[model samples]
Target: MGSLAFFIASLGFLLPLVSNANPLDKRAAALKPFNLRVTFKPAAYAVPSTIQHVQDAVACGASNGVTVTAKSGGHSYGSHGLGGEDGHLIIDMRNFSNVTVDQTAQTANIGPGGRLGNVATALYNQGKQAISHGTCPGVGVGGLTLHGGYGLSSRGRGLTLDNVLEATVVLANSTVVTASTTQNPDLFWALRGAGAAFGVVTNFKFKTFTAPENNIVFQYFFSPSSASQLATALTALQDFTRNSQPPELNMRLFLSSFTTFSGVYYGSRSDFDKIMNPLLSKMGIGSGTVSTNSWLNTLTSFSNGPLAQTGTYDTHETFFSKSLMPEYMSPEAITALSNYWNANARSNSRQWYLLFDCHGGNGSAITKVSADSTSYAHRNATFKMQFYDRVASGNYDPSWMPFLNGWVKSITDAMPSVNFGMYINYADTSLTKDEAHTHYWKDNYKKLVDVKMQYDPKRVFEGPQIVGS
Candidate 1:
C-alpha cells in the first residue's frame, strides 16, 4: 500500500489533533524557509533524481529529518532561497516533465515542474495548444499559473489561470491529491493564485484552446519613444478589445527607449489587413512592417532562441499598476517606479524587463468562478500588471547592490494601488506587508491567512515570498 493508503487507514486516530499539533521545529527540523545568502544551499536537506525517481531521495531526506523542496528547472530568480539559503532537500522535478494532450477533450495534463517548451511540443504532437504565457519557454507553468501566468496570448485568453481546470497537489504531509471544483473545493480556490502558499503542485490540468494551423502576426518598432506616447499606445490597444477580431487576436505594448507592438491573430494573410488597419490608422504611426508565419515560427521569434554556448541567467519581476485604483499616480508612486527600474535593471545588472499582461478572452471567464473560489482575487480586474528587468551579475559594476537596495527603499516609500497585494509569483521576497496585502485585491489577505491556517496550521509548507512565511 502507498503512504496515502497508510494515512487513510490511520486517519481516525490523527483527526482530533491535526490542527493544534505543533509544527516540526524550524531549528530541529533541519530546514527553514530562508536565511538569505548569495549562493543558496540546502544546509540540512537536498535530494537528487534519476530518470523520474524522486521517492528514494525524498525518503532519504525524510529519514534524516529534512523536508524536500522540489524544483523543476529551478527557473525562478530566487528559487534557491527556499532551503533557508542552505538547507538542501531540493527535489528536481524535470525528469518527470512529460506532457500528454487529449485532443478530443481539448485538455492537457502538464507536469507542474515541466517547462512549457517541453509541454508545448508534446501538445503539438497531438494537435493542441493551451492558453499559456508562451513568451518564456523555460518558465514553469507551476509557478506561472500559480501566480496567474501571462503571455503573448493573454490578451485574448485571459491569464493562464483562467483556463485551468485542475491541479494535483503534494500537500505538507506528502500526500498527493487532486484539487478541482468538485473535490477539495477550498484547496482548488486556493491553488489558482496561492499555489505557492498552499503546497507543492505536482501537475496541472488545463483547458486547451485550438491552435491555428497558420498564424499571422507582426512586431513593430517605434522611434523617439516617450513614456507618455507609450502609455497612450498601450491604453489605446485596451480600447480595441471587442467581441469580434476573431477572438484569437492578442495585442501588447512594449516600452523602453524603444516601443514594440506585438500581435498574433489566427487567420490567413488577408486577415492581417483588418487587424493592423485599425491600430495603424488610429495610432497614426508612419512606418511599420507586417509579417506572416506559422504559429510556432512566431513563438520562436518571441523566445529568441539559444544564447551564447555558455549560458546561465536569473530573472526577477515586480508588478504594480498605477493605472488602476485611486485614479492617479502620486509623486511617491512615480518615484517608486523610477527608482525600482533604475536600481534593479538599467543602472544595475541582473534585473531586466517590464511586461504588462492584460487579462483577455473576457476576463469575466475567471470572475464566474467566485471571488473566494480561488486564491486569485483580482479576477474582477481586466488585466494583471507585469514588470520585467533582465540583468546578468557579470554586467554590474562595483556598487550595484547598493543601488538596488536604495531603489527598493525608494519604491516602498511610495503608495501605488488599492490592492497592496503584489502578485505572489513576481514579488521580491522582501516586499512589505502592505504591498502584499493590497497589491492583488484588498481584504483578500486575511482570508488567505485563514486558508493557510486551516490547511497547514503548523505551517509545515514553507513559502518565503508569501505572507506568514
Candidate 2:
C-alpha cells in the first residue's frame, strides 16, 4: 500500500494526520529525534512512518533504551497498533515506502510502511510478480503483510507473507538487523505471523514470480436478494480448494452488499469459457452483470462498480469479525447482509457498509505456515468475515454505532467456531482489550505479548495489544 509519489515528495516535508499539530516539526538538536513522528498530546504518541539513518536514532534511543513503538500507516483500527500507550515514544515507518527490485535475485525489497502499489510496480519493473492484496493502493504494507495478506493475487499464488524471504527490524535495543529462515531462525518463525510485536520492521524482502505473460480473468456480479445464489458460488470455490485443479483456476467469493464472484485463470479467453461458462448455468444467477479485465484495469474499477464505485469516505472506523464460514454467509448471511446494506442504501444520511474479506484458495499453503508462527490464526477458514459499517464519527455520535455493531454481533454469534480472530489493524476501540486480543489473533496474542516482553522488555513497543494499559 505504498503511496509512492507522495512518499517520495515527503522526503524533507512534514505531513501530520492528527490535530493540535505537534510533530516536533523543527529538526531536533541533540535530544531532537529524526525518523520519529512524536505527538506529545494528552500523552506521548509515536508513529514509525520513516527510516532515515534509523541506526543512529535507534542508538540514541537505546541510551535509555529509548522507549518507542512503531506505527506504519494509520490503517489499523486498533489506534494504529504500534501507537504505544501511556506516554511512549514512536518511530513512524510510513516514510519508508521505497520498493526496488533486484534483477539478479529476482526479488524486491519493499518498505514495511509502503503500500502495494509501489511494491507491485517495483516487481513489475523487474518483470517479476508478488502475490499481494491490491484492493486499496493506500493500505500500508505493515499491517497488511503482518496479518497474512490475501488479495487479487491470492488464488494464483498465496498470502503476501508466504512470499517474504526476509525482513529488517529495529530491535528494542535500537539495533538494526535482518531476519530470515537462514538468519535468526526462531525470530524468523515468530515474524511470519507475530511480526508486529517483535520490532519495527523497516523493509521486507519478497520472493518474486513471473508476472502473467498475458492473463485474462472475469469478474461476475450479482444483486441476488437471497443466500442460495451466494452459496452456490461459495460452494463452487470450496470445491476448487478441495481439489487443487489446474494452476490456471482461481476463484474468490466476495460478500459485500454487492456480492462479487471474481476469478482469475492463467489461460486466455477460450480457457475461461471452458471452465466458467458452466458456472453461469450451475449457479442459477440472474440480474447479474459480467466483465473481464486486464492488468491495465484498476481495483476500484473492479470493486463496487458505478453503483458504489464512488466509494464512501470514513472519518474513522471500528472493524469487527466473527468466525463466518462459507456456510454462514450463504442463504442466511447473504440475506442478513442484503437487508443490512439495503437499509443503509436507503438512508440518504447514513453510510453503513459490510466488506467481506473473501477467504478461500485451498488451505495447504497457508496451513503450511504454522498457526503458532504468527499472530494471525484463522488457518481453518476459507474466508475471514468482515464488517465495515461507517458510523457517525465527526461529531462523536453514539447513536447508530452501538445498534449496527450489535446487529453485526448477533449475526456473528450464530457461528462461533467460525469466529477465528479479529484483525489488529481493523480494531475498534469500543471493543474491550481482551475482546480485541481473543477475537482477532487468539493464542498468538499471548505469544506476541511474550515477544514484546522479551524484545521490548521495557514495554516500549506497546500498542492497543496491551490490556488495561
Off by over 4 Å in 1: 1-38, 44-68, 80-84, 129-131, 225-228, 238-247, 268-272, 281-284, 306-353, 360-370, 380-383, 392-417, 440-442
Model 2 off-target regions past 4 Å? 1-67, 81-86, 226-259, 278-283, 287-349, 361-364, 367-375, 391-396, 416-419, 466-469
- Residue range 293-330, candidate 2, lDDT tens digits: 54434344443322121121122333322233342344
Superposition TM-score, candidate 2 onto the true structure: 0.74
The top-ranked prediction according to TM-score is 2
Candidate 2 overall lDDT versus native: 0.54
lDDT of each: 0.54, 0.54
Lowest summed-lDDT stretch of 10 residues in model 2? 26-35
